[model samples]
Target chain A: MGKTIAEKILQSHLLDDGAVVEPGNIVRAWVDVALLNDVNGPIAFRHFANMGGGPVARPDKVVLVCDHFAPAPNAPGARLIGDMRRFAQEKGIEHFFDVGKGGIEHTLAPEQGLIVAGDLVAGGDSHTGTAGAFGAFGTGMSWAGMAAIMMLDETWFKVPESMRFELRGKKAPFVTGKDVILRVLGEIGVDGALYRSMEFGGPGVAELNIDERMAICNMMVEAGAKTGMVEPDAETEAYAKAHAKRAYTLVRADADAQYASRHDIDLAAMRPMVAKPYSPENVVAVDAAKGVHVDQVYMGNCANGTLTDLRQIASVLAGRKVARGTRAIIVPATQQVYVQAMKEGLIEQFIAAGAAVTTPTCGACFGGHNGALDDGEVAVATVNRNFKGRAGHAGAQVYLANSYVAAAAAVAGEIVDPAVL
Target chain B: MIFEGNIHVVGDHCDTDVMIPGRYLSLVEPCEIAKHIFEEVDPGFVKRVQPGDILVAGKNFGSGSGREHAPFGLKGLGLSCIVAASFSRTFYRMAIDLGLPILTCEAAARAAKVGQRARIDTASGEIRIDRQVFRTQPMPPFIQEIIEQGGLTAWVKAEVARRRASA
Candidate 1:
């Protein structure tokens, strides 16, 4: 049997057990990158304090960002940042990004060249799988797991069986990778492919640029897949060409590799989709989901805040005003994407439409920061989550959707079809 | 080491956010996270759970965001073991490394019911459910060490102390 890209990366970092490790196999492997944030950083700092020294390993490999509660919203949050800063300074970790410079941990990693193609990365955040967008095998761990990687440079991995997603025809206009993933969640239901690595292939997948593929793979967690990836191809080559420092080789899964299951999606058949309240897997087409009045519309996160996402939102919102009584909040994913959106005039269109443009942060997605809804409020957000109280008070509701739908919902003051708009 | 506990069965798709949502994420104290464990699904869980209870759930247990607090919360609540049909890969790795015994007994989903007495042997991967015997995937040596040291934080402290004494 031929190897998948995941298999090849695992082999490159395999430990001495010499076992062809499969999922649940106990195997130790090296970490290419390790990331932490304010939430887990303070605990790690306390552990480091008890250990009585700098990091047990080098600092260059570690990334510490204060995106969790940056700007120190309160006294306790401020003190958490203080602990993180002290830890970074003592460890000589130069990659530490303060409040303004740092965004979401996953968004900051790739833009900073920390997550390169073919690299195996680990973070303290579950969305570490977000790095898999670059064709790297990325996952998150606990503070203890991170500390071990900090000390021994190795952690165990159970090689997950692969699930293949083959995209066929082209996507319809106004539809995007976000729609494709929402459709996948609708088909598979959450936990459909548990503990498996869902791999993407096929001609339709190739049409998407790396950012688009990243958008799909980034939300795989919503479907309960541990990680999802597309086999890096020429589009991958072009993406790495600009961001990567050293030359890198693109990788693909072999033809005969084993897969737990396979799915074929025809992008042309898909319509803009939305995941209604309670769960992302609770999906429906835009037309099928009419009249779900939304009090707020948020269009940003590691999932849908790329330059592509902003441009698409702008395409529909341009020259139009946001509907009264609806608040549209636009947050770019990274500094680079923010600058690009500003340069392209997308930011101006968004603001002129009465949308509030905020700095890049993991806000609204986790309900932790800005735009959190009041009790009984309903939000149509392009973020990955929609569980009860996910955006605010327990009585609040969050509806997940693509940027187009979110933009349309903002303009219509309810969940509406972009095509209709 | 072995763990004995009351087992609670959560159905499929017990995600991490449901295990511990973002509102309580600000609380760094594990005890605080413990107060909200399963607040979404089991509103009375935090207040009702006793020490040394095992949480048994269906497939894809602990899916969603990568928050160590999820595991920390459970451990802090005196959750001794988590036996699921399988776990989301990230949570499985984190649980083991953090010294939480996250064992998987594929048959346990069908065999073990809530309020059942479950006994788990970490080294041998044997689980005794009432009178029935079930086998789980045995944790590796390194993970066993973390558990033995009572978790990663304690393990690092022990190592640090050992180094001081030797020096």
Candidate 2:
């Protein structure tokens, strides 16, 4: 009879004329954030202008960030960013982050305190679900959806049913939030949580920090989940209060709340996991991937390039050089992460270890540039997807693993269990 | 809207990337992007999809990146509708916003075959394919309004006009 966190948020934001919405019901609900990046922002902005919709519904809530292909790789990318800047200025949109100020929108929103608990947020990137770690109902919207929200300040939802995940035990050593999510994807397959709210709860969730939880929720998109949520607790409060832009409210699913399915996971028995080439759903134990030679190992992306991930990799690669003939790339998620990692000497340690520490960019992870595989090359990456041609040439192979696994692969020049190190 | 066309069938998880690869994300013109729609799956797909043609697929069609271009391109190519058992949430919204009507009929999705002549009556919620007839739920009134107004953009324009007049 009770509501999930997603239901509560949608219920609160329902339009005045909107009927009460239950799971599977459809209604228009106000969203707190309308976020987009350079890649997709121009299209939505163009659509908005063409609609003759004057001014944004809420300029402050419209966050336009230039991360993907920012610092413009070529004329087209630059033109798009230029168009976005003009739109932001002409429309008086406040949170417009240009090059250097913002990195990935997923990481930037939380860092700037723009997103908080119990909020409904939408971004134009599939990985926008990353913000759900803060207990916000974060999701990615298509260009048309973005345009609608910009013009009307509200969007519609089907009130997705909830799927509850209960982590029962302390996780295994070297296991990560990425590994946990990979395990879930492997067990359930890609469409396991389609159109469902994946709500994380239970004793073992406390073991993960906000960033780690983000790493897990970010990949919920890979499994076709509409959103991933964690009930905001003390840790959530600390993270929110540290950089929160507005008032915060912790939301939880009631004990008697209905769920489509509930999964109880034993974290301690989990093993280091990797998603083999072609699909994030194609997962295997780290042992199964051992000694598989790799040409590159990339440890960055909205999924795993957080400050914690950088620290985890630094601790693994300290005083050791990258393996011969292997390229190691470390990308911080944001300027703040870059600065913090530099201050913590993690960047120095990585550079000293022969790893290339690039600026915060989603480029390499999405196979844009800065780092990409050529034909016949293989890589072990910390990015979420390893779909064909996702990171490089269609003939190139990409394997997805956690930061520790990626770092170990860099050192060993091959995929392997970090526990063996 | 009632439409009759040949069905171009695809299987589950027909991702947006395959529909319109990211390599063409920079192309703002929907028709330009439409030229490459389904370039990977069937290189001649764009050449064959006539105006008002229909696409039918299994579960989880449009399952990749949130480019929004794929649906827009499909619409620009004059695709009348997409009927599938299910659609990725983002893609479903995109299809709706692009004025591309989508009906979810499991019976049609499973029974419809490629190259079959199909007719959809959105108002009647009937899907007729060759000799098979499948029933689907009509779009809710709110969704119908958006479709009638020609996608989200035109709907917003009309709403803005009405609001200004009232004010």
Candidate 3:
């Protein structure tokens, strides 16, 4: 049987002497990138110091981004930044980005050339899977797991069995990878695909750009899938050739690659979907569900702040303005994306449209700054999560949607269909 | 590695925000982190928690961002074990590597109720609750070894020291 793309990457990284690794078998594989941010960098630094590990094999291979709660308003936040700066200077990790230079952990890694197709990246943050958009086999780890990998250049993996998502037909203009992933969550339930790997393919996947692919892969963990992968095709080729540090090969499953399960979806039939307040698993179509009032509309994060995602938002908000009661916040995922959005005048349109453009930080998605909702306020966000209290006050609700729907909802100050706009 | 504790929580995809919010992330004091651990997902989480409690969760437990504090907070607060149907990719690896006992017993997570007392035997991968023994999915031998040695740092240090002493 032809192995899936995930298997191909795992195989390339697997050690020959490791215990027999089968589907469900866990083995520590080599990690190509180990990323940490300011919030957690200090802890990892202390842990690494205690370990007394030799100099990191490759300082440049490690990315230290200070996005979480940086530009500290408190003593704790300021101290974290200071701790990270001293550690970065001592270790000489070349990719360190301080407050102004860094944003979210997931976004900064990719933009800085730390993530590439087929690389195995491990981050100290859970959303590290966001890099899977670039075709890298990425996952998050604890500080200790990261420290170990930093020293040993290896970590454990459970070779997840494969599930195939074979999408068919072209999607509606407003329907996006976010909707598709929500649909996957609805079908698979929360743990239906637990500890499994999902491979997206078929005719429909061809239509998705790298951003959409990233969005789909970004939420694979939500479905309890260990990771999500797309067969590197023409889109992958184009992205890898242009953006990646190295040249690329479009890896795909052989005709007979084994799959544990399969999901066939028709994209054109999909409508604007929402992961209702508190959970991405509680998903429903926007029009089919009751509209809820929102205090904020946040568009950015590793999940949906890419160029493609931004373009979708612009299309919806082009000639419109965000409602007065709602604060529309747009965070470009990376410095490069921020630059591109500026050159394309998307930033001006977003600002004139009454949206607040913040630095390319993880920002509001993590409920850190700028757009955190007060108690009882609701937020419609383009980020991956909608878990309860995710955007600050537990009473404050956060609803997840695609960038188009997010933009539309920002304009309406409530959940609404992007198609209407 | 063996963990005996009271069952705690039935959360779904207990994200990092719940385990440790981004705001308090700047704080390095494990005690401060322990105070807010799971504060968001379950309001009374820290107050209600006991030292030897096990967290049983459904689906994608520890989903969203890879904050190591999620596990570190619990460990510092005297968490004994975490048994779930499934855990987020990074959380699971980090938990075991940090010497925190994490077992996966899909059926156990489904069968066990919050506050139930359970005992886990890491070597045998057996979990006993109310005298009913359930088997957890076994960790790889090397992973088991790491846990046995009190997580990655100790394991690595011991191995290197042993090699040097013999040499």
Candidate 2 lDDT at A318 equals: 83
> Can you write out model 1's per-residue Cα lDDT over B87-143, one digit (the tens) per residue?
876777668756788887789777889788999998999999899999876887877
lDDT, candidate 2, B81-121, per-residue tens: 88998888888877888788998888899998888999998
Return the lDDT, model 1, position A22: 63
Ranking of candidates on DockQ, top first: 2, 3, 1
Residue A171's C-alpha lDDT in candidate 1? 84
Question: Going through the candidates in order, what is chain B's TM-score?
Answer: 0.90, 0.95, 0.92
Task: Indicate which candidate wins on lDDT.
Answer: 2
| Ranking 1 against 3 by lDDT, winner | 1
Candidate 3 chain A, run of 10 with poorest lDDT: A242-251
Q: Which scores higher on DockQ, 1 or 2?
A: 2
Residue-wise lDDT of candidate 1 within A200-284, one digit each (tens)?
Answer: 8899977687667777878877776666678887777777777875445566788988787889999888888888878788999
| Candidate number that wins on TM-score, 2 or 3 | 2
Q: Which candidate number would show the highest TM-score if scored against the true structure?
A: 2
lDDT of 3: 0.78
- Candidate 2 structure quality by residue, lDDT tens digits, A1-421: 7888888878878886557768878887888888889888999888887888677888989888888786677788788889889998999988988988888888888889998888889888988889889889998887877887888787788889989999979988889899889999998878888888899899898989998998899999888899988778899999998989998788998889889999988999999999998788899999998889999999888857799899899978987889999999998988999999989999889989999998877876776777878889999999887766657676788999999999999999998788887
**DockQ for candidate 1:** 0.53
The top-ranked prediction according to DockQ is 2
Chain A TM-score across all models, in listed order: 0.96, 0.98, 0.95
